[model samples]
Target: MPLDPFLADKVHLLDGLDWPQVQNDPQAAARLGEYLRDPGEWTAPDVSVEDRTVPGPHGRIPIRIYTPATEPGRALLWLHGGGFQGGDLDMPEAHQVSAELSARASALVVSVDYRRAVDGTHYPVPVDDAHAVWRWLGETLRLRSGPSGPVALGGASAGAAIALSTAIRLRDLGQRRPDALLLAYPFAHFPNPALDADTRVEMEALPPLLRFTTEGIESMVRNYVGRLSDLPPSAMPGAADLRGLPATGIVLAQYDDLRPSGELLERQLGEVGVGVRSYLAAGMTHGHLNRGPSLKEVDRSLDFLAAVLADGAAAPAEHPTYNG
Candidate 1:
């Protein structure tokens, strides 16, 4: 399928934009935000939201907690994506997704505002923050002992890498793992898997701003891990030992360059005997979750994630794939 007509019509909003420049310039960043902002006039469902900080490796980690009006069904800790350098709790990917999941799944959602890979910051910092929050939640919520409902860990793009890395860290440390994992258009590999011929041709029609060029991905990786040589498997985790990780739910954008990475991860997980559910958001681009739930694909993707959390880590008898 081609780009969704809704997004294709708005492609002009990102004309002449550069991501690195957008990162450094507030005006440029605002323009990119405007282009990614949801155009629908829908409002977020009612959910009690609280802003709080917890101790982290470096300092306090800010997080937003969302609680539904009804009884909580599951507990989720979600992180937003910005190539590990941008994004915050206010973004639709973080705010709207958390709000919707809280209401739709009746889950208690905690959205982390981890430190970005800026200035001299590097890998392990963001992962450390996420791990700290997970430990804190474990202590407060009694996740290890007899507790309330199932708990899930999830994220989008670079944040998904961090979530997986955190899961790996927990496994290595002999800590209790999350009941389930949710990843949305995850960038799990440094040198991403090559796109198929059909996908390559399909991506050629995308605007430059919507494309993740080789140079751009390399730059993002270098910024996050400092030097690209001797890269840590935990930072990317595409080639890491994934055995014993929780059942995973992945959402891939049909038109995304990073889709191959998510697909590869699904295969890798299945090979390692982990239950996996993969969903392709047809006609959507990367970070579609960043758009408001008013978009049909975005809403469906969120629903899939909610269902995963609701189901926990139980391995399905067979892998299930969804095309939204």
Candidate 2:
């Protein structure tokens, strides 16, 4: 559980700060936005980007579409992460991850620009945006492909939390377990000391320290869920009974504090007899999936997700349940 010397050596420790301190500082959360803005003009030629929107409860929500050369007949519903406070579909990582998966699996990747909590969106608002986009895909876009490779949901950090709840709800409603789920440095654990020592160290290694702080996480959780529940899966993945969930591929950073949550979620999934694949990328930190330099791991995760989801469509006829 030692601090990632690579990260610790490169950055300053995040002394516990009050929620207002991190939120009002502005510069704290602004760093990620700055990074996104300066992500350079680099882009894959095979990837195509387009702007779109879907009707939501309050209003229409914007989104970005990344599609491959050939439509694989399945789409990935991606929710961009910003602690539910910051971030957009145009985020550098969001663009890259969506495009990477698109090219890898030849499926459509839709990134949602939901209402952020920074302006008091809170829980169900963002979660509702996710539902609106998903419903649009199901009803309008028609995500069903012979029921084998239906739509899947995924995201990072706060977005991952929203995706987890959305997927769980989808399964319980008997709609369809996403063919597959790709979660990177997923924010699973809530503000509790239940985490192991190693997990704590890994989370600290993540850059943009202010966004993932103790209070910052709580603020996101509070904003997402109006009132706290005894064990609300809406905020904490571990709180959910993951039985019947989709085939899950969790991409975690070895040095990320959130790493334990991924492993724990995997363990819980296994306990329920759900097929789970867990990948721990070495020398990486939370959000490393988007860090330009750490793209090697991110690429690996996307490739695996492509295969996993595509396999749902290509499964042997007998076991064609499409546990994607």
Candidate 3:
């Protein structure tokens, strides 16, 4: 099938922009982050945003909290996309998504700025920072009080990878788990050059205007895991035991290379008898949930999150579901 007209226009617009190769270039990553932080490209949703730092294993972790007009007992801890290297707290992918979800879900949204490996922050650091925030939010919100009110966890791309890892860590430590988990086009597994040839070919088959630079994607993946031996189930949940995780919701982009892993994770969760639902955003590419032009899909994702947070109530029937 061809791309949607709106999405095709978006692809054309992106092709005209200047994007540097971030492979081995920290400055390029920084520049990309700055480009994404432009306020002109995003309108702040109607939500109160705050900046605060929480104690972490090595140091303080910064987080932005978004409070909606209608107060609710529940909250969501959100992690932003950047392939575990480039994203920041103020970027639209992080801030705007948090704001919109807070307003639409009527739940407080906490967006964490975990350390990225691209900055030489390294593995376990990002995971540690995320875990710290989760614990702090749970204690702050008193999540153990009841089933109706608990902090949910989620992220986009690399952030989604962190969310899944943190959930596993918490469960292993015998700590309280999140009420639910949400993943948006998550790069949930490490790449296998040999086995991923078909995946790469599929991505390359997209309109030339819409495909990502090979060097750029490879850099993101390399910086994220460093060495293959370092890859653990905690960081890449696709190879992990999925039996004990919380109710899971995944949003996958039809044109995303990562879609296969997201589907695989859904199947793994189902095999373990976990409650899971996946939303395939048709005609969309990776990171569509973060792009301003893809507002319809973004709004739908928020609605799905809100529905999932409502305990004892069934998920709204409108969302297309792939339960596993």
Reference-based lDDT, each prediction: 0.88, 0.67, 0.73
lDDT (tens digit, per residue) of candidate 2 on 141-162 = 5534422255778888778878
lDDT per residue as tens, model 1, 156-214: 99999999999999999999789899999999997999999988998887778889999
- After superposition, the stretches of candidate 2 with alpha carbons farther than 4 Å from their true spots are 1-41, 143-148, 192-195, 198-213, 227-231, 312-324
Give candidate 1's root-mean-square deviation (CA, Å): 2.9
- The residue-by-residue lDDT of candidate 3 on 44-114, one tens digit each, is 66888899999999899999989877766678899998878778998777987888778767778999999
Q: Once superposed on the true structure, which residue ranges of model 3 sit more than 4 Å away at CA?
A: 13-18, 21-43, 143-148, 192-218, 311-314, 320-324
TM-score of each: 0.92, 0.78, 0.83
Number of colliding residue pairs in each model? 0, 10, 1
lDDT of 3 at 237: 72
Ordered from best to worst lDDT, the candidate numbers read 1, 3, 2
Model 2 residue 236 CA deviation (Å) reads 2.7
